[model samples]
Target: MSQRNRDAKRSAREALRAQRERDRARAKRKRTLTVAAGVVVVLGAAAGIGVAVADHGSSGGSDSAGRVIAPKGAIGKDSLVIPVGAADAPSTLTIYEDFRCPACDAFEKTFTPTIHSLEDSGAMRTEYHLVTLIDGNLGGSGSLNAANAAACAQDQDKFRPYHDVLYSNQPDEQDDKFADSTTLLTLAGKVPGLKTPAFTACVTGGTHKPWVKKSNDAFNAAGFNSTPTVLLNGKNIYSNASLTPDSLRQMVQAANKGKKPGTVTTAPSPS
Candidate 1:
């Protein structure tokens, strides 16, 4: 071949090589962009999942500390009242009691059986407003702790049994036995399924302490200065001099007379 022809062939080969290099570079840039877009999508999905989890935690009856807040329709901010009888019982009896109060223990001992009987018989339903009075009168977390644990028990539908047990096993008003979560758990063992990890976490972490304080605030706001205060049909029955455990049934019967058998006219009265 002539020298010029040979040079032309070499130039063509060089041009082909340059074109192949450009194609490879373009493919590499496309691959890099695809990988980057995939990373961005994955990161976006992870961030969205994080936000959903956080939203659920906040709105699902939990406080910022991950503690259970008061259940709906709870009286006075954080006080949980488990109704003992029919939902439509005519006469409503409200009891404001503290776990650490000796007076409350006496009141419970004297009236709990009768109250339960009345409740079972469908004559009346009782609303118990748990307070932490002894914690204020005495210097300790016993009342607050016990009340918190009791509120926690409500979450498990064991509030009534646990309430009875706490009153039955009341320590001295000043002993502060309820301050220890272990003692509360030991008591909870009496109720079936009450000693689970959730209950333990609630009691030990003082999850309901803020709720207990709110209850106490409600009690104070209601002008009650004592524990074991009882009200029947909006009347302060305990304030009456003739009130007795034996007379409680008669009072409920009288309150229901001429009124509907299952009509409660008032919300829970604070103690």
Candidate 2:
């Protein structure tokens, strides 16, 4: 009857769904590795992830999987957070997402404008905790590879646009095309000046693969079992069925009610 009760129920339902997904992942991992010719993993049924086509894989470029190379300016514990927005912003939005996550893409598409506006205005800061949920759940390296490439972009201070580009071109949940260095590099062309020698080497060498693994491990340890676990000011708002961009804005606005917005300058947007 109450909003709090409704939110609680929604959280319960989400938790149950996440548990089922985790169970399915465990079963999938236990099955002997089998690659049937022409057997493509479909998304409509598995987790209801219907999205655009692209690649998702980890096999192509993984020479640096053994090394933990955090991207430029990575902060927080173990250097796992790729932060956006001003450091002194009045509010903080923590997002744990996977590059291969359909839900995450949908969320980004729906909320990016509002989030960006808040960030640009210095009302909030976003900490992106990249994870490989789909890769672990569905058997691919797309999530990790894409996250690494995004990290590489961060090296050039281009993580924001490059991040949007990857989601804009997210592959089928089952497709491992994102694992190919060529595919990743090609996508880099979408972001201006992102395709450079250092960026290329970072993607091809999987320089941030180890860091991704560490972050994923942290995700598991934190009792989170799904992609796109979003928390605003330590409150889990994603589970609220009534959550929307406007409502999010209201919350942030209220949080920053009498506070002065930060003065950090945002990077130029991509064309």
Off by over 4 Å in 2: 1-67
Tens digits of per-residue lDDT for model 1, 1-271: 5786455445434433443344356446657967987787788788884312221111123576766577334553344565656677787898887898776676676677788777766678888787876665556778888888888887776777888889889987769999888999999988877789988888777766766666666776787656666899877776432455668888888877886655333322111
C-alpha lDDT (0 to 100) for residue 198 of candidate 2: 87
Top candidate, metric TM-score: 2
**lDDT, candidate 1, at 271:** 16
RMSD of each: 32.0, 10.4
Any idea what lDDT model 2 has?
A: 0.79
> What is the Cα-based TM-score of model 2?
0.78
* TM-score for each model: 0.69, 0.78
Candidate 2, poorest ten consecutive residues by summed lDDT: 32-41
List per-prediction Cα lDDT, in the order shown.
Answer: 0.69, 0.79
lDDT of 2 by residue, 124-220 (tens): 9999999887776767678888888999899999999999888888887778888787998998898888899989988887777777878888988
Clashes of each: 4, 9
Clashing pairs in 2: 54-171, 55-177, 55-178, 56-175, 56-176, 56-177, 56-178, 57-176, 57-179
